[model samples]
Target: MIVTELRFENYRNLKNNTIVPAENVNVIYGENAQGKTNLIEAIWLFCGGHSFRGSKENEMIAFDNKYFRLGMNFFSGGREQSADIAFGQNRKQIWINGVERSSSSYLTEVFSAVVFSPEHLNLIKRGPNIRRRFIDAAICQHRIRYASLLSKYQQIINQRNALLKDIRKHSELKDTLAIWDDSLITVGAMIMKERYDYLKMLREPAKTYHHGISAEKETLDIEYQSTTKTDENDDFGTLTGKLRAAFDASQREDFYTGYTSVGPHRDDLDFKINGISVRRFGSQGQQRSTVLSLKLSEAELLYQKNEERPVILLDDVLSELDNSRQDFLLNKVEAYQVFVTCCEESNKVQLKNGKVFYIENGVVK
Candidate 1:
């Protein structure tokens, strides 16, 4: 996927602006708080229409401004497409090709963007939720059905929890608990299957990239840490049945805890380097290298599945790497569209064919 044009108005500190980026690599440099990362975020948000920085809608509006708007024209499916977004304090609207659409229709067969930021360097050491989110966000882009199932599963869990809370005061509500359990088990099983399939496809590439970055000294291993053991040869029916049984076994405990106790919501991704848990055993460099490998692996996996290299947004990531590692990263993504944010022109990683833009107080020059 390639973005042919991008423009923003009243977004963050940036004024009405347009960015013309080279298809290969675009390097953006500025001093601290000059809106370098904000520019990167605009591209990511417009491409996928989701916030990678986890900012809310109103927070993205410029100070003293009424609203924010972004326009993105991209090339996908051997043709061009566009998305326009407008957001205010309490409302947001999205349009695809001038046709009003909801944000729910995104990432099905639409645009894909892979991002790497400094905060992700702690993926291995952070709580399990971060790692699970990493897998969910990446997989959801490639398979829209997985996203639907995830949403339904979350809803089922919420309903089940609410029922549990009511059951404490009125024991009569306990009889209908099986209805939610069945739905949760079915959807949760599919979610687990998809996550397992994705990680299974991702493990080899992540290890290869990890070995390249670690100089063959570290081996990356990934696995699913679910609430219950998964069967290898079971079909969907059998898997659902097994999960349902597990839920039934945990029902009393869940009722006591006032929530659904066993499902993918509690699942995690287990990472190890050379048979040792990276969370406790890996050094700082090792953790960063592992996260980098996984992210690059995500880009490669998307390309393999979609037949289009995703637009990569690097948010002030190179500053944390050495010269060799920086060069290696640039070399790895040279063939795809990339946008890198940095603090200085001298600190930029030189590329064979890349455009450089300067930013000052949110204006691109």
Candidate 2:
């Protein structure tokens, strides 16, 4: 699927405007804080992604403006489609075509986007939560049910944690913890299964891309260690039973810790070159290649699962890569729609037939 058009009003420093992106590749360049990334953010939002900059909805509104709107026209599944989103400090709503949808779940149904930003370089160097978020965000877009189960599991964890804390004052709360445990196991098990399954599918593609980008000098391996025995092919019913047993064993310890300690919340995705971890021992180049491999793997996985290539959002992601690696990425992604952002005009992304846009003080030309 490719974005055919984008329009936004009162968004950041950007003036009210409508844009028609290139069918294949587009490069957006400007000085820092000149709204280059803002353009990419608008497209990413239209593709159903939250701000890679982590800005709040209010921050997206223009100065002195209380509301912002983002709209997009795209071609997906052999037809034209559109998505419109309205944003405010306290409220946000999305509409697919002209009909309003209940939630953002409909966003993924119409379009898919895979994003890469400079911050993702820390995917390996960062803590487990970052990796977990990487998996959650990517998988949620592919499977809406994964998002639902993951959200339910998170709510169950929060409520269960609060109950654990309250147990200090009301000992009777201990009896009801089992209720949350059941829900947690039921939902958390599904989350773990989906994560494990996606990671498994991602492994071969990531390894191959890492091999190509690294010039065949290094081998990439990813292992998903879920809270349960996810490596095994146990059915859902059997997995639920195991979750129950694990939670039952951890009940007393969880009560004392005032948190739900055993679930997907604590899961980790391990990255290795040969047999050593890229996290602690890998060099800077290794880490960069690792993240790149993971990203390309993400795009391929999305295509394999959805049968459509996702739009690639490179939010200043190439600065971290060497010229050779950058060339490798551009070549590999030539068949897909891409948006690349750069701070300098000399940005080396070779998009011969691609449209180049210059942004200055919020204006694009």
Candidate 3:
């Protein structure tokens, strides 16, 4: 998918601006905090119905402004389409092809975007929640039902944790805990099963991409870490039984800690390089390569599942990589539409066909 044009009003530091982006590679260059990232953020929000930076709709509006508006024209699957998203302190709406609609209804219909930022380097070394979020977000884009399942699983976990906490003060509530346990096992088991299936599909692509980027010297392996041990080929019935048994064993400890301990929420993804844990043993370059491989793998997976490639969003990430790595990234994304930001044109790696937009003081020139 390619974005033909974009218009923004009262968005971040940009008051009112419009530009037509190149289909292949569109480059935005400016100094720090000069609206380069804000432009890309607007495109990402249009694609995903939310901010890649985790900002709320109101937070994305311009300073002292009451509302913000962003509209984009896109070409995909040999057809032209347009979408607009508007939001204010109290209201938000989305329009597709000139028809007003709910944001969630058609959010994923226009396009898919994979964002790379310097902060993503933490995927391997940071806490487990970040890694889990990465997987969940990718899965939700391709499998819409996964989002509802995830929400239900989280609700059940919250209820189960509350019940565990109450059990400490009143032993009588312990019997009522069985109801929450049943709910947790049902929803949590489905979540775990879906995650396991997704991970299985992710392994081969991720390993191949990692090897290509690392020149075959380093081997990357990803393992899904669950609270209960189960074979890779185990069905949901067996896995659910194991999860129930594990939860039963951990009930007392969970009550003491005031949290449900054994479920998908507590699970993690493990990355290893050449038989060593990437988080503890890999160098900085290795960690960066691992993250890049994972993202590229995601793009490939999306393309394989859907015939069209996902759009690429590079948020000042190329500036942090060496020229060799930058070249690899640029070459890999040659076929898809890419939006990249940098401090200046000279800092960007050379590309065959790209349009450069100079951003200065919140204006695109």
Candidate 2: segments with Cα more than 4 A from true spot: 16-18, 64-71, 83-106, 151-188, 226-260, 347-349
Give lDDT tens digits, candidate 2, residues 1-365.
88999898999999888888898878888989999888888887866657888888788889999999989999899899999999887688999988888877689678888777777877898899999999998887678778778777788889999999999899977789888888888887788778777877888999899888877878999877667555547678887888888788888888789987777899888899997999989988788789878987899988888788889888886676677777766566667888888876545656566688888899888
> Which stretches of model 3 miss by more than 4 angstroms?
63-67, 88-90, 102-104, 169-179, 346-348
Rank order by lDDT, top first?
A: 2, 3, 1
* Best of the candidates, lDDT: 2
What lDDT does model 3 reach? 0.82
Worst 10 residues of 3 by lDDT: 324-333
Give one digit per residue, the lDDT tens place, for model 3 in 1-365.
88888999999997597899888887788899898888888888866566767788888888888999999888877799888888886799888888998654586876777777778888988999998998898888778899999998898888878878888889888888888888788887888878878888888888887777766777889888887775557788987788889889998889899998878898889899888889988888888888878887898889888888878888886665666666666555577788888886745557657788888889998
The sequence of per-residue lDDT tens digits that candidate 1 reaches over residues 1-365 is: 88888899999988688887888888888999999888888888766556777898899999998899999888888988988888986888888888887663563457777888888875787788888888998888778787788888888889989999999999998889888887888888888878878888899999998887766778999867778666544678877887887788888898899987777898887788998888888777677777888887898998998898888888877665666667766666556898888887745556667788899998898
Which parts of model 1 are misplaced by more than 4 Å? 15-17, 67-69, 80-110, 158-182, 231-238, 241-245, 248-252, 346-349
| Best of the two (1, 3) by lDDT | 3
Better of 1 and 3 by TM-score: 3
lDDT of each: 0.81, 0.82, 0.82
Clashing pairs in 1: none
